[model samples]
Target: MQDMKIADLPVHDRAIDITGETCPMTFVRTRLALDSLPDGAVLLVRLKGADPRANVPRAAADQGHDLLDMFDLDDGSAILVIRKAGA
Candidate 1:
């Protein structure tokens, strides 16, 4: 899908908060959340720090998921919307 505003993205199927997590663990938790969903499921992940913001989406995409939308909140944390592959 073409890049769209976060507000324009579909409602998420699941959500997770990883603002307290770091690096590999950030993606690990995200991966676990994705694994629990059916293909094409949408997951919203709230994360902090530049590492997770930079890594999680790339990792999810590497694993065949689609990065639907991502945006930073006013509080400085960010959200990542991922769509599981296979739809």
Candidate 2:
């Protein structure tokens, strides 16, 4: 198997923007969204700032989800791709 580029990933099952959110709220919102998803669903999280850029993916992975990818957008924010853990 080969690693897919961020652009090659399938369309996300859901997407949320947390560019206006900070720290714990960033992960909080992300967790809430993940909780709403079915097992193995993919989520696209749009976030800004160093805190969220670093924390959301780490926290999601810690909670047993898969961190597919994290990459920057041209506008300065970044996108985090996560796959919900199978139940």
Candidate 3:
């Protein structure tokens, strides 16, 4: 099948892989990754399973980043596009 990835959705500054993890863990990993990025940079988080779909965007919003977009793939994965807020 075609790779339905976050990159295929829209332009972003960076892409992060968190495919093998679950809920809170997925959120945690995304949070840590965002820390290293400069404000205004976009992060494309790729994760497999359900929790990432529900939780990642919520976590991103809680952390002050804008949840730019989200894509649910046919292969049972999700892509969340988030933009870090300026400090």
Top-TM-score structure, candidate number: 1
Compare candidates 1 and 3 on TM-score and give the better one: 1
Encode model 3's per-residue lDDT on 51-81: one tens digit a residue: 6787788778887899887777777776788
User: Candidate 2, residues 1-87: lDDT per residue as tens digits?
Assistant: 144365664589998999999899999999999999999999999899999998998999999999988877767888899999994
Least accurate 10 contiguous residues by lDDT in model 1 = 1-10
Model 1 spans with C-alpha error above 4 angstroms: 1-10
Candidate 3 Cα deviation (angstroms), residue 45: 0.4
Clashing pairs in 3: none
Candidates in order have lDDT scores of 0.88, 0.89, 0.81
How far residue 21's Cα lies from its native spot in candidate 1, in Å, is: 0.4
**70, model 1: CA deviation in Å?**
0.4
Residue pairs with backbone atoms closer than 3 Å in model 2 (clashes): none
lDDT of 3 at 77: 74
lDDT of 1 by residue, 1-87 (tens): 234465764598988999999899999999999999999989999899989999998899899999988877777888888999999
